[model samples]
Target chain A: MIEVKNVAKKFGRKKVLKGVSFTAEKGQITCLIGINGVGKTTLLKAIMGLTPFDSGEILINGEKIHPGTYEKITFIPDTITMLPNMKIREAFTFMADFYNSWNAERAGELLKFFRLNEDDRISDLSKGNAAKVNLILGLALDVDYVLMDEPFSGIDIFSREQIADVFTSHLIEDRGVIITTHEINDIEHLIDKAVLLDNGVILKEFDTEEIRENEGKSVIDVMREVFQA
Target chain B: MNVKFNNRDPVYVQVIQHFKEQIATGIYEPGQEIPSRRELANQLKINPNTAQRAYKEMEEQGLIFTEGNLPSRITSDEKVFQRVREELILEAVGAFVDSIRTINVPLNEVLQLVEQNYHKKGDSL
Candidate 1:
């Protein structure tokens, strides 16, 4: 289980998370949804300890995650294009070295499912293939939590379907995954819980089923109503 | 598997049933690889994630498995396939039974109609 207790973060006069507290239980896929610039990425960074929060505490499995505990979750950043020097194979090695739960078997299985070759450099790959590699690496980790930011930002329709299937097949049953993305149409049925952020605060929080049953709405429909789009 | 995204129902469950029916009818043979999720979603014109969810449902139910570098294939174990096929027939027949019962049709009349249709279908085949 992951917990964010009264978390608050601010920059200059703008407050991003205002005492926001929530729990993402094990074996659940919770989506962190908000429009662009609503601090969805910030919340993910904060949870992963990549960003500093002014106040509030973060916990994984009931233990406080302080300066340490960074390895409990894998963070997939939005702009994940690392230096072009490393080949896709080498990049996987680097990540595997750091993560204790790195499963080479699962990783290789996904790469083949997506038809990605290891010899190709990360920079040499096309946008679609590159995104597939990025998502595969983040998801293949056997850790308790995985956080992804806009995983499908630039992916094409065809690639999206193949990559999404691999993710679902490989997701661990008893772990928490937080994905921040604007692609609600793709993930609405997969998300068990959703947290909608607006102007640096949680505008709405509910089970995905609640929205469907009560409003007969998809995640996109909820965004239209909540964000007034 | 073609999955319909309805607000009140889980899309993955629908996908699982679709695969079960196809497999039972020999549309997809055991050990045969199914279409990549992108292909299925493109054919259906829905979100790829929905297709992914469907595949996940199949794996959890032990009807399929993924081989590295290969597409997902139906499980070859007869026990698993037989169980899933039986479940599918029951679900299918159960729905028909409920509908017929709702209209107050007699059970004996339904059985007689089934016997007539069975021979007629055999002659056509």
Candidate 2:
């Protein structure tokens, strides 16, 4: 399990992530939902240790993150980070060289699954294909946890659906996933838990199925009650 | 294998409901092998954990059974199969009765309309 306990951060006194706390369990897809600039990206970056936090602790399986943690967890930013001139295969080579956990066979399978060609240049690919490549980069790792940032934003509907299909495939079967999305309509049924955030604080954290079963309310319905209150 | 799930029900409950529907319609035969939980999740585009929960519930209900390492199969017990069909029928009829009662329609008239439309729809199909 990945536990974020009472984490708070500030960027030159702008105070992002105000004492946020949540737990994302393995074999479950946990969603961090908020509108734009609610510190969603900041929180994910803080967990990945990409940014410094002022207070609180983040633990993975009861240990602080270290160099070895990279082998067990991966963070995929929203945008493609490869050099624009690199071909998809070249990018795969770059990842293989950098990370010991890179799985070439799985990478090749994901390439085919996304119907992407290795020879395609990153700069020349369409927005949806680029997003697929970004996702494949993290998913092909043999890590136990994956943190994704706004994977569905700005993509076409078909591409969004194709990405949603990944959550159900063996590609993501047993790993813990933390995805941040401003919009939930596309993949409402794919998530296990939702942690609602607003203005750098957690508003509500509840199991999606529990709300539906006990309250007969959808995630959006709960969001409306919370956010619109 | 395609299920258009609603957002207001627990996904595991929805999955079991789908299985019950398939069993009632004879689309899944008695003693036939069903897809593994992972396969069902992929086919329906739902979370694998939800699929696992549904399978576990079905197993507890005796709707499907597994022996040792073999794949799970639909119940071959004739009484259980008959009960599943009757349960579906009664549920549908109960919903029909509730709606017709709300509209203040007599039971005889509702039965007559059902008899007329059921065959007409079946023939057209």
Candidate 3:
């Protein structure tokens, strides 16, 4: 399990994460959900050690996060991280050279599944295809936990559907997933737990299935109640 | 596979309901092989863990059975199939009765509607 306990981060003078804490368990999909400017992305970066936190602890399986921890945790930032000039084939080659955990066979399969051409330039693809490439880059790695920031944001409807469908595929099975998105409807049924963030704090955290079963409420319902008030 | 699930219940529970409905309606024949957990999850666009839970519950209820390492199949036992059909019919009847009660429609009106609509549907079939 990946645990974040009271993690706090500040951007110069403005605070982003104020005592944020949550756990993402292995073999389950945990969603970090909130409206805009709630530090959802910042929190994910803090867990990845890409963005340093001011206070609190971020631990994976009881060990503090370090540089080597990158092998076990894959973080897909909200924006494209690959170089614009790189072609899809070159991007795969780059990843294969850098990350020992990268699986070329899985990357090949995802390339076909996403209907992407290896010769296609990263800068030449549509926004939807670019997001698919971003996802394929992360998913092809054999990691224990994956943290995705706004993966469903600003993409075409068809691409959103395709990305959501991958959550159920064997490509993601038996691994922990932490996804942050304001649009929750696309993955409502796939998420196991939800951590609602607001104003740099975790407002509430609960099992998505438990809310549906016992309260007859969905994640949207809970979000409405929490965010509106 | 494109089953429209209601949001009020756990997704896994709804999956099990869909499977039971398929068996009761003969859409899935007795002893027919069902999709693997991963295949079901991909087809329905749900978490694989949810699919696994649905299959586990169905196994407990004797609705499906796995042989050794083979994929699970709909239960071939005659008694189990008969029970599944009867249970579904009873659930539908119970729901119908409850709805008629809520609107204060008398039993005679509901019976008439059921008889007329039932025959009309059968004729179309």
Candidate 4:
């Protein structure tokens, strides 16, 4: 389980993640939905300890995680930043060395699941395949938490479904995930909790079913109401 | 299995998840003759390529094995069944965790609830 409390961050004169706070449960897929330029990526980076937050606290498994605890959360940024010339299998080996929780079998299965070749270089892969490689690496990590940024924003439809399947299969028991994405339809069923952000603040955070049953409206409908109102 | 006219995602891959669920719940048994590609595609309103993709995925996963061009049947492989069962169990556990978390139940309470339910079910049995 992970908790972010009163988290605040700023970039130059602009403030992002303005004292935002939320709890993501273990073994649950919690999604972050926000329009462009709303600090979704910044919040994720803060959680990963890749970016410094100005104030507030982050705790994973009740242990306060600061800049020093970056290992606890594995992140796959929207951009594919891995070396362009490394082979697919070599990427796995590199990951295994860096992450204590890397699972080779799971990684291999994911490569097959995504229909990716081990001999392919990261640079030679099309945009979709590179995303697939990022996904494989993120999912195969045995970390307590994963934070993905816009994982499906660029992939084609066919690759998108396969990405969803890979995401679904990577759910480990009691681990947590916070996926930031604009493509909600592709992952609607995969997400149990939704947090909507606007202007660097959480506008709505609720269980998807609670809104559906109590208000007779789906999360997408609620988002429309919030944005429209 | 039609490929060109259908989706590049492949029909057989689609069938893999569906039949895995069916087999997990005993809706489809080993040695059972699955519906033909044409019938399945019509039922699902998908192209034959999708059906083929599903079948091929299931076959590669060892859930089903085809002998010649005859009616494809579910594999009677016990090992495959056990693997599928474990995977389904893991999935069910994940869903259960998601359900509890959505209600904002604390982690300790959830673990206690699972423990209580486990014993209750054991006693009932």
Candidate 5:
């Protein structure tokens, strides 16, 4: 499990995350939802130790994140970080060299799943294919947790659906996932839990199925009641 | 296998309801093998944990059973099968009565209309 306890961060004069707390369990998908500039990415970055947090603690399986934690957790940013001149195969090679957790076979399977020719240059791929490659880079790792940042934001509907299909496939394989998104329409049924964020604070956190079963309200309905209020 | 799930209901409950409907209609035969939890999740485009919950509920209710290491199968119990059909019929009739009563329709008139439409629809199908 990944536990974020009272984690807070500040950038110059603006506070990005204020006392954010949540637990994402193994084999479950937890979503962090908020509007733009609400620090969703900042929180994910803080968990991955890519960015510094001013206070509080983040524990992975009850231990503070250290240098070796990279092998257990990975962060897939919204944009592809590879060079435009690199081919998909070359990018795979880059990942293979950088991380000991990289799974070449799973990467090959993901290439077929996304229906992309790895020989195609990154510069020549469409926006949706590029997103698939970006996701593949993170998913192909043999890690216990994956943190994704707005994977569906700028993709086409079909591409968005293909990405959503990943949650149900064996490719995800019982790993804990923390996904941040401003838009929830495409993945309303795919997530196990939701944490609503606004103005650097958590407004609500609840199980999706529990709300639907007990209160007869969807995630959006609760979001409306909380955010609108 | 396509299920257009509503947002307001628990997805696991919806899945159980779907299985009940299929069993009642004989679409899923007795003792027939069903998809694994992961396969069902992919088929329904739902969370795998939700699929697991639905399967667990079904197993507890005796609607399905697993033996040893084999995949789960629909229950072959005749009593449970009959109960599922009867339960679905009662629930559908109850819903129909509730809506029809609100409109102030007489029972005889409602029964006659139901009889007429039911046969017509069945014939057309």
Candidate 6:
């Protein structure tokens, strides 16, 4: 399990995450959902130890995050993180060199699944295809936890469908995932837990299935009530 | 199984309903092996846990059963199959009656409309 306990962060004067705490377990998808600027991405970054937290702790499998944590936890940022000028095949080779967890077979399958050409440069592909490549890079890893930031944002319908398919496929089997997104329609039924963030504070967190059965409300329904007030 | 799901109810419930409808409509035959949990999850693009929950519910309701290590299959017992078909038909009738009752139509008029519409497009019900 990945645990974030009382994590707090700020930039100059503005606080982004205020005592945020949550746990994402293996074999479950934990969703961080809210409007823009609510620190959704900041929380994801904090978990990755990419951005320093002011005062808090992050633990994976009951151990404090250390240098080796990156091997276990892979974070896919919203924007393309690959080199802009690198060809697709070169990018794959670059990733394979850096991480021992990179799976060449999985990368090959995802490349065919996404229908991405290896010869195309990163800067030459369309917005949707670029996102697919980003997803392929993240998913091709043999990691335990995956933290995604706005993976479905600003993509076309076809691309969105393809990305959504990754959740149901064996690509994410038995791995913990933390995804932050304002758009929930694409992953409504797939989310196991939901953390609702507002103004750097967690307004509510609950097992999505419990609320659905007890109150007949979906993630979107709960969001309407929580955000409208 | 091109199961079309809406966002209104819980997905597991919708999935269970879809399976029952499939059994009632003869899409799933008795003793036929159904998709594995992972296969259903991939085919329907739902969470694997949700598919597991749906399969569990169906097993509880005797709509499907597993034999030892084999994959789950539609129930082979004729009585169970008949019960599933009857339950689905009753549920549909109840929904139709409830909706028609809200409009305050007379029972005989409702029956006449049903008879006319049922044959209008060669619908089975």
Stretches of candidate 6 off by over 4 Å are: B123-125
TM-score of chain B in each prediction: 0.81, 0.97, 0.92, 0.70, 0.98, 0.92
| lDDT, residue A104, candidate 3 | 91
lDDT of 6 at A63: 91
Best by lDDT: 5
Please, what are the lDDT tens digits per residue for candidate 1 over residues A58-108?
A: 888888666446656777776654567788788888878876777888889
Per residue, candidate 6 scores C-alpha lDDT tens digits across B1-125 of 56776665788999999998888889899999999998999999888888999999999988899989999999988998898889999999999999998999999998998889889869663
The TM-score of candidate 4 is 0.64
What C-alpha lDDT does candidate 1 achieve relative to the native structure? 0.77
lDDT per residue as tens, model 5, B1-125: 68999999999999999999999999999999999999999989899899999999999999999999999999999999999999999999999999998999999998899999999999999
| Candidate 4 global lDDT | 0.75
Report the C-alpha lDDT of model 2 over B24-114, residue by residue, as the tens digit: 8999999999998899999999888888999999999999999998999999988888988999899998998888889998888888999
Instruction: Score every model by TM-score.
Output: 0.68, 0.98, 0.95, 0.64, 0.97, 0.97
Per-model lDDT? 0.77, 0.91, 0.89, 0.75, 0.92, 0.88
DockQ (C-alpha) of model 4?
0.02
**Candidate 2, DockQ score (0 to 1):** 0.86
Q: What is the TM-score of chain A in candidate 6?
A: 0.97
Candidate 3 chain B: 10-residue stretch with minimal lDDT = B1-10
Docking class for model 4 is incorrect
Compare the candidates by DockQ and give the number of the best one.
2
**TM-score of chain A by itself in each prediction:** 0.91, 0.97, 0.97, 0.94, 0.96, 0.97
Compared with the true structure, what per-residue lDDT tens digits does model 4 show for residues A34-137?
86675899888877777889999988888877643555678899777678889998889998887677889989998998889999999999889899898888
Model 3, runs deviating above 4 Å:
none
User: What's the DockQ for every one of the candidates?
Assistant: 0.13, 0.86, 0.77, 0.02, 0.80, 0.68
Q: For candidate 6, what is the TM-score? A: 0.97
DockQ-derived CAPRI band for the predicted complex in model 5? medium
